[model samples]
Target: MQPDPRTNLNNELAQLLNNRIVEPDYKREITITFRVSSAEKTRLEQRCSGVVQSDYIRARLFDYPLPHPKLVIPEVNRQAIYELKKIGNNLNQQTRAINEAVKIGSQPLSSNVKEYLQTIKELAVLLEQTHASLSQPISDEE
Candidate 1:
């Protein structure tokens, strides 16, 4: 007995689809292929402007330009932390200045002080999180 057309279509649909693995190349040329309907392609293009069918297809298929990591020596991070600590005192002083300026109705000075204080707060939070992550102790429950 021959299988029904709908049954054959279901069997084909069940076939495993895997990506074509390739070597890592940030700027290397690549190709992509998909069996998308014309309507689907048009919808995608309309939603994301300046994206031609070919460009979208190529982007999906190939490795595109990716930035290389900036070289950061371990010592650089240490120096940065040290500098951050030194600047932390200045940030505190600026925060105080902001309060004084606000009292004097110096809106511009107050704004600058608020900006500096916010930056300092962000830096402090980041430093605290980094230190905590690095110095996590083993739990007694282990």
Candidate 2:
């Protein structure tokens, strides 16, 4: 028996980590149709990896290059990123409140401003490290 189309699609998609051309094409007005199981369609969407569905289909069908498939993000890293963003937002709010206070002369501008800036820099470095670590799973290393 012939191999399943889904399996073949997966195999073909494994090599899709190259960049596509940047020119516009007018011949893409033609349409193609095919049937896929619901689960297979989900798989296709997953493999599309943030690209437009039609673009993904055309690349697959025409044997063109595509970006690295952005599959599942790491669970731990995802949570950490969320928590860090929350903390950053809260910090920013507090800093803005302090700035407003200083602007209104209700509070004196302290030398600790330098210290707060240093803390923000540290937080930025930490977030960047986390971002790089989280990106490791989905980023194309090839």
Candidate 3:
């Protein structure tokens, strides 16, 4: 007995129908809700004229530019800091020289040495003041 051709044809047609392609849509799957005053709604609709409401809202929501933070160092402060560092290095070298001279008994404590030490202390105070001033937030008045 021969197999039925109609049955085979029916099976082929069913297979082809089952294998047909289906394209997907591009719509999002989530929904959001918010309350707005009637005036605000009117303003938004006016701004969104000639564009779809959802597109305008989505662009405003997701494509807006955010303000970035900034670090500003004033030129005066930079120059002052550089000068302070140089002065600090000079003070350190002078202290080391005095210490070495005292250790070797080459120089004795004298009025000139005391005056130099007083000047170094004054310079240290000035450096601290400059650093504190630079670290403070800049005021609008300045």
Best by TM-score: 2
lDDT of all predictions = 0.61, 0.74, 0.74
**Candidates' TM-scores?**
0.29, 0.52, 0.45
Candidate 1 lDDT by residue in tens digits, 1-142: 9889998886776652343434555675767566879999778766434445564544555543333223333565666656666776676776687777778887565566667768878977876776555444434376
- Per-residue alpha-carbon lDDT of candidate 2 for residues 1-142, written as tens digits (9 for 90 to 100): 9989999887777655343334547677778788999999999988887787887876776565765554567788788878877877876777788778889989787779757856876886787787677766655564
Error in Å for residue 90 of model 2: 1.3
List model 3 lDDT by residue over 17-131, tens digit each. Answer: 7764434336779889899999999998788654666667765655533222233558888788788889888987898888789778898878898788788889888888887
Q: How many collisions per candidate?
A: 0, 0, 0
Question: Which stretches of model 3 miss by more than 4 angstroms?
Answer: 1-71, 140-142
Estimate the lDDT of model 1: 0.61
Score candidate 3 by lDDT: 0.74
Give, for candidate 2, the lowest lDDT window spanning 10 residues. 15-24
As a TM-score, model 3 comes out at: 0.45
Q: Higher lDDT: candidate 1 or 2?
A: 2
Residue clash pairs of candidate 1: none
